[model samples]
Target: MTHTRFPKAVLFDLDGTLVDSAPDFIAVINRMRAERGRDALPLAELRPVVSKGARAMLGAGFPDVAASEREAWVQEFLDLYEAELGLHGTPFDGVEAMLAALEANGTTWGIVTNKPEYLARKLLPLLGWETRCAILVGGDTLPVRKPDPLPLLHAAQAIGVVADDCIYVGDDERDIIAARAAGMPSVVALWGYRLHEDDPFAWQGDVLIHAPAELCETRAWPGTGTQA
Candidate 1:
């Protein structure tokens, strides 16, 4: 096996990449829609924008509403969801094991998610991961977020790893963009929540992981004697 140059650290996105928070998010979206006398969207429809933030989900679920109205709806959605956060969310299968593998290998791992820190922190304990993660950089942790690279850079700094020595794994384009901008290698998580219109293979990350467990296998990491 060809040995790929393994990174010293791996930063992951929380919502879709590490945890299956879509169900929890959908529940909140539907609740908000119901309160507004509007019909709730099916899980499939809302799943598409799970990574796009509350604003995108609000706009998609309330397409007939004006932009200003949507903004208010978004705020309401966040507020409501925050109250019931993590009720239906859980880490993806093999997530704990994967994290363990990283720890065993002496590689640092952290979370750099677009989710607000309070909400993200709230979920960590339920998954029994509150203290395991080396660094937790949330949407509110810094002034900027994914697709901007600042969060990724900050996470790398917090984890004591350099951009080139770290890999960022996420289920969205923003994750790849952030990794690229931060000069880190990235993997597209195919196992996470994805829209029907999206294509992980074409997202152009360093690698495309098929499942959560696959990540723990060093063979999947390029240059680790794994195929490119």
Candidate 2:
């Protein structure tokens, strides 16, 4: 693995990367289905699509709902999800310890997600991260979101860190792509959600970690230039 000086900041993708938000997605979708006299979907069925966002979750939840109309349901899905957000969501196993490690190492961290800014802000307090998180760049925070690379670059700049000094971590292909475009290093969170056929190795992240606990290892952070 390539090594460099420790990163000044570590920017994360919110939903699947930092938090296990699949439960909340299940709650919102089941609630919506129940209201419409439909059956609830299982977490296993919907979990993989949570990172894909509202439309994807809804598509799985309401398969009967046409793809064309799923876009329209996005607002309602997000609204209901806003209420159910942190109630069912928690940091993925080891996330707390990982954050603590970052703090102990004097490295700053923030979030850049496709979730809307208002919704992301609401989640901070619910997750008890309102004060601890250094910065947030939501999908609506900028003109474009991930895969565009601007949001990742913007988040680094917002926190007064250069792109090379920030590391982006997420579970999606777009996350690695954006980091590459921004000239930033990236870590693929293999513990996060993905479809049955999804191949993370192909994402080509600078590092691929199986669990948040793996991040606690010194080797996971390339900047230290030492194997754990």
**Backbone collision count in every prediction?**
8, 0
Clashing pairs in 2: none
lDDT of 2 by residue, 161-187 (tens): 888878899998888899989988889
Quality of model 1 by C-alpha lDDT: 0.82
The deviation in Å at residue 205 for candidate 2 is 0.6
TM-score, every prediction: 0.92, 0.94
Off by over 4 Å in 2: 1-6, 224-228
Number of the top TM-score candidate: 2
lDDT of 1 by residue, 49-115 (tens): 8888888887778778887878766667878888778888788899888888778777788899998
What candidate 1 gets wrong by more than 4 Å, as runs, is 4-6, 223-228
lDDT of each: 0.82, 0.86
